[model samples]
Target: MIYLVEHFYSIQGEGRYIGTPSLFFRFGACNLKCEGFACSEVAPDGTVVVGCDTVYAVNKEHFSSQWGKITKARELLNILELYELPEKSVDIVLTGGEPLLYAQDEIFVEFLQVLHQRGHRICFETNATIAVNFFKYEIYKECIFALSVKLSNSNEPYKKRVRGEVINSIATNAKDAYFKFSVDAESINLGLEDEIFDITSHAPSADVFCMPVGGDKKTVEANTPMLVEFCKAKGYNFSDRLHIRIWDANKGV
Candidate 1:
């Protein structure tokens, strides 16, 4: 079964395709909590939850009420129709707590199959932990991947967050792919360069883009100067969390 946390039509807010008019499908659940990033929310039950900025999407126990359960590819297709988007012109971004968690689901694969058949460009904004079997799911070969792989800053262990073999596979097999790391001032001071270099080494052909880690506009602002300089020093591209910048702490944007 596939679960969709939310769907919206918005401009691509980060990475290679930033600002492009796009349709977003945010899936629920993820393998990593990324508590190190330190974004938190209090649930109705008075439990404090922590993780990456999209904690609501990750903590299903608290936010499942907002997620739409999907049983068929047609249902998603119908959701797309409501937007009345131009034929195959808008970029389709598959994002999540971790969208590829559903990689093997029959319905998930069917949705990708139909999207590809219709000529829409698909991009997966993933943490790069879950590697799709591109040989079996050949349709993924036609899509781009925004590899938002986690760093030590995420508080996830190296073995859990960084997968060298999986990184290489996606870079080598995907139609196009790139690395996008979420960094902060502290992580930058803590030798993030070495860690980032080690991961990117696994995918030599992919370009790297770094964006400040933040859940709100203020935090993002605080981290930006350092990250911009960091990117400049490393000759990497700098991406902004434009969605957060524009719609701070708001859902369904």
Candidate 2:
């Protein structure tokens, strides 16, 4: 079953492919709840809530009520036709609560194949915790992986977020993969430069990208210069959330 939370057309906001106009398919559900005090806020009831920007997709308890479940690739193709994608090659940004969570589902894989056959560039924005076997799932080899591996700042326990085998598999199999990390001052304070080595020790091929971890422009601005300097010093790349910078973190852009 392929559960979709929302789909839209927008410019690629970050990573190596920044600023490219693209079609976005946001899948529903994820295996991790990467909470962090840095991104948390006190609710009206005084509960501190750790929310991801797309919590709608990740919080499965509400997903059935909100997500659109599609059983066939034809239905998806019809929907993409509504968007009237360009005649030339444009990227299909497959995002999620973790789109690869559906990687093993044949129907979902067929959806990907159809998009690929149509000449759309498939870019997956993943947490990179799940590994793909390229021999069995050849379609994955054609997609670019925008790997945003969760870090200590996300408040997920080390064992849950970092998997050496998963990292090795993506490094060894995916057509091309880039390691992007969500950053905050706390992450730098914790010596994240050293932590990157620990996580990518197995698959060191892709360059690392660090984007300020914020949902709004102001928060991102506050952290940008430091992150840029950090990136320069560490020889990692820097990516800004251009959508947030331009549109103030509005959904369905």
Candidate 3:
């Protein structure tokens, strides 16, 4: 039973695959609320802290929004068909509220396999806290995993967030996996350099992307220079949250 938060067709607005046309499937429920990452005071609070980003889908209390009902795999496929991009090859981005929370399920795996068989490139935007034994599946070879590891500045407890062992295991085990970290100026100054070193030590060969934590143009602009400098000093790539810049943290983008 997968509770879909929302689905839409848009350009992939972040990471190495930025600006590519893609279909987005946002699933409901995240293990991490990240209250400290809130973008504005208008943001709602509860199990899910609502901010500029993903305001509509995440509820005020639990971050669980009213997104219709549980959808079967076949029905989801049908829904996807409606927004197919025929001119160019499309990438399917499975995002959250944490999609991996349900990725371990039989139906979800089957759906991924079906998508793979049809020649779709699947990208997973994951929190990196959950250990997905994706290597056990054939489809795993076809999928590109984006491990967006959360840092200490996210206001999440160490135990509740950064699972270095799990991240290391995934980095060592998974094929085509990359590590992306979300950081702010304060975090960069405090210990982000050390954290980045630790992550790269585990996945030395993987390309690392350091993205600024922002939900609006102002925040992105304010933080990008600092992040850019940090990345330059450490020989790392800097990623901008393009969706937030263009859409102002609008949901279903």
Backbone clash count for every predicted candidate, in the order shown: 0, 0, 1
- The reply for model 2, stretches above 4 Å from the true place, is 37-49
Question: Could you tell me the TM-score of candidate 2?
Answer: 0.93
Best by lDDT: 1
For 13-130, candidate 2 gives per-residue lDDT tens digits of 9999999998898999888877672454344445555667676677666445668888887877777778766788789998988998888988888888888887888999999888
Candidate 2: which pairs clash?
none
lDDT of 2: 0.83
Model 3 per-residue lDDT tens digits across residues 89-163: 588899877888886777788888888877778998888888777567656657787888777776778777777
The number of the candidate with the highest TM-score is 1
Clashing pairs for model 1 are none
Q: List TM-scores for all candidates, in order.
A: 0.97, 0.93, 0.88
Query: Which regions in candidate 3 have their CA more than 4 angstroms from the true location?
Result: 40-52, 55-65
| Clash number for candidate 3 | 1
- Lowest lDDT block of 10, candidate 3: 43-52
- lDDT tens digits, residues 53-172, model 1? 888889999877777889888998888887978755788899888999999998988999898888889999999988889999999899999998899988899999999999999999
Cα lDDT listed for each candidate: 0.90, 0.83, 0.75
- Global lDDT for candidate 1? 0.90
